[model samples]
Target: MRGGNQMSQLMKQAQKMQEDLAAAQEEVALMKAEATAGGGMVRLVMGAGHQVETLEINPDVVDPQDLEMLQDLLTAAFNDAASQLDQMTQERMAEVAGGGLGLPGF
Candidate 1:
């Protein structure tokens, strides 16, 4: 009877943890991370779900003669935003899971 009660309690705790994780994931999906490059001439906003929410380019950075430079700046801004979003999601998940998920190979 004691062992059964302990197992039941553990199952309940696991279910609660799973619920918390799902809620945290939903919150993170709605969060946004922003990054800029070329002195803020290019900006990108990314969601935790790895989706680009918005992108802005300053008129001053648009040069028909140097499209390559503009492309490079855009790439840099996108990479920065994606990286930020990844870190934010990971940190949030860790917090939700109480430090770590404890899964093998993470």
Candidate 2:
């Protein structure tokens, strides 16, 4: 019947979309973003899931007389990386949704 054929076609399209979304999620999870502060004395690396991957501190920046400065730089770098990660997730989700109903997950 015509209705049955249309339903089958729609199901196939849905399955394809699901597959594409899964691929996109996988790719996004692997993406990385970095943020630095204090003239690059502190660097923060983040993954798409907003997880901190690494923290690097330049030895030259470490001064016993200015430990507070180093701490501030580390804090700023981590905050920046977290904000950037949120932006990245939003962008990736938009790309995967392709302007669809904006579902929470795909």
Candidate 3:
């Protein structure tokens, strides 16, 4: 009977862990990270899921003759934003996982 009780307690612990992880994921899903490039010519905001939420390009940097420059700045900005988003998401998820799911067996 003692062994059966332990198993039951373990099952309950696992269920609680699952619930916490789900909640953490939800919070992470709504998180965002931001970055700038080309001396602030481009500003980008990226979601935790790697989605581009907002991208703002300074009008002065938009040159029709030198479109390549604009493209470069955009690329830099997006990569920076993506990197920030990745770091933020990883940190958030780590917070939930680092507790070892609060399970004694783990």
Winner by lDDT: 1
**Total backbone collisions, model 2:** 0
lDDT of 2 by residue, 1-106 (tens): 9999878877776787788788878877888889999888888899866788898999999999999999899889988988887788778778767845334574
Candidate 1, after superposition: displacement of residue 38 in Å?
0.8
The parts of candidate 2 lying over 4 Å away from their true place are 99-106
TM-score of each: 0.85, 0.77, 0.83
Best-first order by lDDT: 1, 3, 2
lDDT of 3 by residue, 3-76 (tens): 99889887887787778789988988888878888899999998866888899999999999999999999899
Distance from true position, residue 56, model 3, in Å? Answer: 1.0
> Model 1 TM-score?
0.85
The C-alpha RMSD in Å for every predicted model, in order, reads 2.9, 3.7, 2.2
Cα lDDT tens digits for candidate 1, 37-81: 999999898886678888999999999999999999989988888
Off by over 4 Å in 1: 99-106
lDDT of 2 at 70: 92
Highest-TM-score candidate? 1
